[model samples]
Target: MGKLQLVNIEKSYKTGNSSIKVLKGISLEFRESEFVSILGPSGSGKTTLLNIIGGLDQYDAGDLVINNLSTKHFKDRDWDAYRNRSIGFVFQNYNLISHQSVLQNVEIAMTLSGVSNSERKARAKEALADVGLSDHIHKKPNQLSGGQMQRVAIARALVNNPDIILADEPTGALDSKTSTQVMNILREIAKKRLVIMVTHNEEIANEYSSRIIRFLDGEIQSDSDPIEKKDSASINQPRTTKKRDKTSMSLFTALSLSFKNLLTKKGRTILTSFAGSIGIIGVALVLALSSGLSNQLDVMQSDTLANFPIMIDTNEQFVDFSELGPPGSEKSNSKYEEFPEDTTIYAYDYSESFIMHKNVFTDDFLSYVENIENELPEEVNNISFTRGVGVNLLAEGTDGVVKFETMSQNSMMGGFSGPSMGFSHWYEMPKDHQFILELYDLIGENSRLPEAENEIAIVVDEYNRLSTLFLEKLALTEEEYDVTDFVGKTMLKLLPNDVYYTEAENGLFTPANP
Candidate 1:
């Protein structure tokens, strides 16, 4: 039986608003041992038919049978496997990757087949040697002549030992001398496998092909030899074939190709990277400046509220919701009108009396406040001047790094300007107070207060015990180690929040440069 058969294949393409039929009820057969040449004028669908047979295009109607198995139900991966395992193609333009060596170009087919590295190289070398280009294996495509490049393409097609070689005008770009060499190679390849060539050169096709088929207007015009049609029952019966592995190119191979391509166009790659970096840096700087300004504004607001007794909320109003009627009922000075039965209002028509005005404290307004502060009466106590600066405490632990921060002093102003410090577990000790003397007497110790920026004191309860949950969070459980040993041994890294967090593209903060 022939290796491939097409049964009344039909294909069409939609161009804008009209459909053009490319193939019209075409039927043909291909054997494993014949060299067939298809000849046709341009736009006659010869190349389209070849592409369909090669699994590069799909036929809209009718079945393509490969080894008596219908290919009508093949999925994308199945087609990929079929092409990788059974088909090889040589085009008129060679289609060789310009940056890759001749051997690398040949090895690409087997790369997708999941072949071993040593065997892939050996096969590639053998294929190149067969094409009499062993000495030029390391050369790039651009370095070779047109004929040499075409031979390299043939080597690439044969590297995987595909069952069929599809040549589309293999000698279209070559002189007569070079064309003869390529045809001779194809003739040799046809001895053991099916070789189908599409060409317009009548003399070359007649000389090289064992059978010639002419195509005109999407139909077969003449055939030197044609297979007789078998009964539908006999033709439709599918013979069991060995299950094949899915064809896949490895991620490493893909990245290697990309890297090589990048290396080939060094100037363009460098220019692209430089341009992208400039844009990225510009965006990063703008975001960083915006974030810094926002944080500074929060600090200014906190300072303002701390130093002054009055707080002004711009673009906000405090409303009393207690005066409103039940949820979804409109607020009214009079009793609500009775509605029809089974009707309950789900929305409210309400108007607010409070007017919105910008309460922003501009520099001019702050200067006026300063002038008032200077002329204040002696009865008023001195206003406290304070600045809110955040610090992040980091410690290395058995699990990972641990960070802690005290409750922000700005939290007293309101939740508005409050930064996310740690939970409210930290307290500031009052300096030179009578309570400190009493606490020393109760604890039976006279420890000095922290005097350095990096120094801190951990306080325990009257029972000289610490919270177990807090200890676990810091990975400093008593069962794991002597708590006393950690008193002086443990070290913490203190960084300003500005130094710790960097604004990212998504409007959140990530670790600086990380």
Candidate 2:
């Protein structure tokens, strides 16, 4: 009997209105101490099959037997036990905890398996030494290079001394040099322990595995075995390539190797790891603050706005004012001033405002705002602006200049009389009877109206061009003539003869007398 067996497996999932089947009836057998590789293209369900075999997930219908134990009927507790004792897993992402030291990350599996502290430490140290990460015991995940981090993950997987190691794209993220190193270590381990890896790279898989299985569309297409099984009498005899009698280092030996490695570059490793630890500390603080604030807001909002249902209310809304604050307070006010007026700033409001806009805002927009709100200033309130072609302006002077443009036939016919205009207009228009056409150039060639204000703000063709002329018939500098400040404060006043007035709040009369 093989060490692992999958018999008549089938898997399917419900898509919108129909069921999509991935794996058909598939059967396979893998012997102990075998180095096997499952090779396939993307979306071939290689990861899914590996996960099922590793006890990370359940198959819809299958008989999965590992080391003579049937896993198809295993309960949650049984699966956990099986995973701890029977299988080890290595992932492409190197999912090592950044907060934990390299040694600590490796010891996690043994700890979960309830191994003694001394034994776990010794095993983890040994595993690291085997993977050439003995010198990185105290370093966090980010402190090491990508190759070293993956090595740490490998050590973690091996620390528990499981019967089988299941690797999903083990060297997918590593370059050739590092990948070779990793593959060699895995090959060495497979001499005594079974190593089954999922890979897209055929060369690496062929170089390391004695047996290769090709998968397509979630089914095993081909199985090629290099070593043939011996007769019953020779089964008990160890093969030449197999190294069963070779003993792995004990915990003490491993720990000694780890310490010796560390001693070689003590200062350099400590300093680099310390710098990495600082980054981890910063990230931890940020995450903790964000999570804590989010929880507090949730609680406060829940308590205050229980009746409101969707909206929240709070007493104080924090604002970042560094952008608008005095220069000296830039650093101090930066946190508050990060809030943009155009963006909706939401807080834990215990009022009706939350409930009111719940349906008004798009689902995507609300989700985006909710994700960053706790990390950003809370002073932002919902505010929106509507732009129109003409707004009522109260000019200061009695003879204020009134400048207006007639709606084109397209605009009038389409009823685009509101803020949202739909028609287009061209430059170089004929001079009217009453108004003199002073400036009539496009911001750029083929300009759109909404973006026209920003793109066509200045005349690029003419250097030292007169942007505006005063009633005093005096030439003014561009800075003196620029009316951007006036535009924000002023309103538009309609008058006869297609004219309008630019009335400022301070009662200043600037004519758009084009």
Candidate 3:
């Protein structure tokens, strides 16, 4: 019996409404210590056939017999054993673990086969030495050149002492010079192992194999003697490369080499991974804190507020008096007068209270907003609106009172003023101001107003508190303004009116204006 045989193999895959057949009644036989090359163009089912032979994939219909045993009847464990004992695969990408040393990678196949540690190491070292890579046992796959890495892959394949090696486009990504080196190594291995390689390069296939099988439209077009002789003078002749020591190393030797490299570069590796660890920690912390805070806020707000509470304030005055007023003046009356045409406004219909400015509603902007809305959960209910206004703060200088626009809420009031700091105040007006609107949609029943409007008239209570604490502790002043200001202002406009409009004993603010 031949070392491997595929009798009347057929494979198909369901694509859309039809089945696409890849392999069509392919029959092939490979003997021990034979080098066969399957030459085909892209989409010729060469890789799929190789995968089936390697036990990585199952053929729809076939009789795959290896070493006189029928693989068609093999179970998972049987297939695993067959693959472990009979086949070694090398891919075009040289699937080496970048983090592992050359020796470690080579030893992986034997380790997977449950070979003893000492024997695995010895066999891996011997294979590497055969590939002229004994010295690179401690080097990572990335540290070696392309040709050297492919040699490492060959060494890995040979370490398990498998009877067959299946290489798929082994030299596909290498330069012409490096490709020759890789082919020479494969040619040498085929002298003792059944090396079946799939390649598109006809010249490389002819140079290394005694038999060349051409595949077309997923069928074996021809299986015949190589048109070119192995002795043909080709550019890929084996070169006199530097050879390493033949003495094999123990498993401890390889492990020691890896440990030494890790120790020598511990700081760099640790630093590189530090940022990743920090990122994970930050994400965990944010989720934990946000969830906890949200839960507590939900409970507190739900127990106190009704579905809607009466909002009592001057017409068109949405500013929270608690933040803009003094500590004891939370319930103080504002000096501003109401518009003559003003009437009681209902907060329940506030969803349609403000219209979005046409300037801010560009197609691109709407598209972006729509994309963001799409990512939200489907249970959302209410949406809030906000507007931004530029207001000037009057500060008394040494000579005169100077008016300056408040560029940022965190701006240093001490820089432009004397000992007395100029605080911000919100004035009610009948005229609509051209300002940016920040809207918050109520998604869940437990949703609470943003703290910006909840904490009196503060732009963003939490952020302002944090910024004040930071400035106080560090004794620092603002150097640059950030978008955080806009976010804070936007959130202020999105807060529920009840949070800032009603008395504490009256429960939450109502949607009906009083």
Candidate 4:
């Protein structure tokens, strides 16, 4: 017997400063297998009483006993267990998830009870078949008629095989014919379980229910004689069904159910997901753009730096060298008249000055550098030196001639600039002179540095600039001759010092061509 007892049940709500009493001292008892109808007008505490009995809401100052088990010490978890294992709910509005199939709706009770996936699906299909929805098991709620959706709800309520079925207006949304069909299902279910329903229609109540209960103004106006109260005293326990459970709420199960529910409400779920992801999507796009731009800037910087040679200094007072780039970046040379090479004198007189030379760049210095290079963790293939000399270039034609000079300095500006002396020399071309150019940006096409005798690979920057200078010497604009691709087309030859420089009457140096 699905026996239930309530003693002195009290419930109230507070709005503003007033205490609104809903169920004032509601006392009632019920026995098993009775089709009971609760009749009441609006706000007569019928639904509230039903909810309290169903454990959906709590009643203050009440002793509710289910199958002789007092709920006085029952916690929320106990109530939840009662709802899952004992009571089944059927509402007037069906409350079927629109996207879920009839079978899935029935499976919800089992899912919440932590039934195994395979087992729940099988049981869900069985419950639907019992409600004559076996053919529509795969249909969504929206695909069904009002009667069919209500049938699915009934199937769901019965899927757990609960002891007490609390239905509120189960036939309220159906037509007269459909209402009669629903009442038949309820009567059939009441044969084994206790069916307590709330309804306003007196004809349905008087005709279908075995017991009638009337409530008015938060008080029980009438409670009909129990269908068989004497037979219920022997029912000391609720009915039992196999496979029903009081399962604990598992995190994995909760997430799975939540996700399924989300899928049922596709539009709202998609809208909420999109809204939440807006900031994340924006951040990801920003990071992508920033990374791409950073990569491009690194490529540009690498191209600019690759054209120049790497210089290492052993001078103790220096911190860094060549901080500025090529083109107009010449070393500052305003302080000293004499060069460092001239400061070291040898074998001149018997009275010689003692010199304590620190670690400096020398011929034997490279041997020590080689030793250090050998000790490096990475492989070292070759180490060679390319001398940088101070030199100038001349372009001559019928219009006249122009000289492009390279600055050679005497002092280093805290090692922050390249040697003032350029790599080119005015030395005479005796038999053959080979010059190699480091063109960092031209690595993909005709990219070999000059290694053979008399071979030259001129860098594009110097090549284009020299071509522009030759145009200027001819008194012409650069637009007349495109210097964009001037890599392999250029040729060069070395010059002699005496032919390029001459002494003037003022004891100063001058270009020999002028």
Candidate 5:
């Protein structure tokens, strides 16, 4: 039986949506030691058949047998091992790597086969010397002539010491003299191993190949020497023993090649790095600015809250403005106007300037809030309570005791006290001295918070304006008198509710005796 056998092999290629059969049931056998040339025109499936024999391409149907072992069960790694150890390829273009030296190109195949560095170099030098390229091994492929480049390719193909050498138009790019030289070298190598070549030159094929096979329209037309069919006993020969170490490349070798490839294209490497860094830096700057602005806003909010303390008004009220139109509108409209049958007014008319909604807390709810304030000190600072108490202020004038309707009179201010009025609550001194310290900061040395029950601080508006009636009652002119003059001034009479009134019969009130 022959070393290589193809039994009714078929191959096809998909072009767009149609399948084109390249090899239509090709069957052939090759010997272990012969220079065989496959001769055909372009697209005659000559190269495809050669590729299939070398394990570079797979057949769609039928099987390829190597050393009496079937290739139908061969996986990707199995074909890889076969290509690395048993076959070598030479192309028409002398396909040597442009960036690598001739010697490095020759050693690459053995590198894939896991050969040692020292053995690879020695064998590569020997192969180059065989092809008469020993001195030019250190130069790149572009530095060589066409003949010299083809010699480098031949050296690379032979360096692995493969069982079969598959050459596709090895002389297609060389002159007659160089072609003769290359053919002589291949013929010499064929003395021990098989040499299968595909070429279009019939004259050279007849003179060089030991046997010539001609193809026509994807079919073998003629064979100078063809082997007869083998029996079933020969087909059932024992499978070749699997080798322990399969084909592989070391990590160091792979990285070395990748680094050399990158060095060959310096402009692409730099451009890629610059573009990537610009995107990363842009995202980083946006995140940093957003974080800084959020921190500043938090600090501003805390300072504002400290200056204006949070309060829960016991007499708190609201105005339902749901039906109000946009600001400065003439009238209100119902939001649910589609349901006109519902005759319930839920909000005040926008035409009305003032709307009142009282939300009075019950005694039980007030007790619950006070308990929470005492229990959760960290959550609440403190709670201060004030009643809507009305007071009558009296001062002794050059005449008799005069009565003044002060701002502390809740009944007089109740109509305007709310969010719109700003000064919503009026009360005496708080138990905490922090209120006195704050009053000192606001009014300077001339005024103080009410410490004794008989004294009171004359609080002013944001513009520091005081009521003219109260100023006249205190015997001071608002325009000319200094505020220091009003300090420690005495009033003729201070009549509180307990001193000025008494409960008469039937819950009626009456004046007390002077």
Candidate 6:
């Protein structure tokens, strides 16, 4: 409740080349617990005067004071607080948010004042119960008729526990019976606080008001004290202003009210959410595609360059210690010496190659490598073996047995230290038929590998040279012998004089020395 004072209040509006004065120097004072009716015709400044009194509009030149505090001294923030916390309004149109239910409509004001959910619910229910609309709390405004909607507006005004209630033709749109019901609620409210009602009904002003102030041409025509009017029903109650609670709007309250409003119109809410998120989803998809392309490029590069150069040395137990040229210059073995045609076998292209010291390639080595390859990750496709190797062969020819050697070379890099390690006497190991077939691409004049185990194949010139050497050693005539193909020829595979060991079934080692 507030003790409202208007001191010589004046207001105007501009109309092109002229000014129209609305309120003509009105001065008045009002107290709480008084049902004051402001009576006037259309365009007589009734609503303007009510708006000025409620702090909704400003007077051009006058002092409007509430509770002894002049509004001229109030800032914008202070005025907002006063409007939200101290004043309540009841309008002719009901002014209910259409999609919101009765409970949500009533909860709107207190929700803006930072009241918790539980407390707001309890108080909103109590206010609806007072208006006899408790059963329809979940119904929307369109579900109710004129009188019920007006009652809901009344409940919304009462929900905030405001200090003053300002009504502007609150029952103008309803029938006589509904209007009476709405007026009765205002009368009950005026019993405890001030309610300034703007209406043109003379009978209602005389019957229900404690005082009546009439206006004509924007000035007060008559101020009645209820004792002067016939059938005056003013209550002789002492007026007192209630101290106001200081609470402001909070973010949580704003969000809670927004959610309630959105729930009332779900289709509109969904469209709005999509409108805000489309660009974000597009940006995220673009970033994911960029990362996927980068990973694929990396995988392709690794597959192209994963194979490394390896040197398998059959001898490993004894160190030669014989220095040749320098630490970086290694002696080229005579076994890899140039053939009669001074030819080179093109093997592989690698950036840099390493040397591996191993005893020999045997049946056990193949099984060990197969087990190792299975234990690795699936991306490791060619980890077990790379291509290049040197071949040293001793086989039978047209006359008898002969010895020859071949080597695979890569000359891309130079001036690097070769591996220094121990050596042992040379030894030969058994190999799979598929292993020999792979070498046909390099050494066998585009011919296939040896089809039978007893047969042997070599480079084209090496085959011709070995035939000549064997014929020279046996003193055989070249005209009588066929040296075109060696497919059906026999071969004596000779192993070096060295002791080799195999793992026995009893976990003991068995040695074979040749």
Clash totals, every prediction = 0, 16, 8, 2, 0, 2
Q: What is the lDDT of candidate 1?
A: 0.76
RMSD of candidate 1 to the truth, in angstroms, is 20.7
Candidate 4, residue 333: lDDT: 34
**What is each predicted model's overall lDDT from 0 to 1?**
0.76, 0.64, 0.65, 0.70, 0.76, 0.68
Model 5 clashes, total count:
0
Assess the local accuracy of residue 98 in candidate 2 as a C-alpha lDDT between 0 and 100: 71
Worst 10 residues of 2 by lDDT: 429-438
Per-residue alpha-carbon lDDT of candidate 6 for residues 211-258, written as tens digits (9 for 90 to 100): 899988899998985222222223212223333445566787777667
Ranking 1 against 3 by TM-score, winner = 1
Q: Model 1: what TM-score?
A: 0.59
Model 1 misplaced regions, further than 4 Å: 230-234, 239-242, 250-255, 294-514
Provide the TM-score for each candidate, comma-separated.
0.59, 0.45, 0.47, 0.52, 0.59, 0.50
Query: Candidate 5's residue-wise lDDT over 275-322, tens digit each?
Result: 889989999998988899887876555334434555555454555454
Model 1, residue 208: C-alpha shift (Å): 1.5
Candidate ranking (TM-score, best to worst): 1, 5, 4, 6, 3, 2
Can you write out model 3's per-residue Cα lDDT over 1-514, one digit (the tens) per residue? 3567777899998989999899999878777777899988898889889999999999999688776556666677677777877788888999998878898889777654656777878998999999999888999888999889999998888877889999999999999999999988888888887999999999988887888999998998898853233322231222223222222445765686567667767898798679889999999999999999997876555333323422222234444443354366643334433454667653344333343322334569656644543466332222222234444333333344344333332212111111122342322211111111111132235433334323222222322222443222223346544434433332222223444246545565533231
Q: In terms of TM-score, which candidate is stronger, 2 or 6?
A: 6
RMSD (Å) per prediction:
20.7, 27.5, 22.2, 15.7, 11.6, 19.3
Model 1, 63-132: lDDT tens digits are 8888787887788888999999889999999999888899989998798898877898999999999999
* TM-score of decoy 6: 0.50
Q: Which portions of model 4 show Cα errors greater than 4 Å?
A: 226-246, 249-274, 281-514
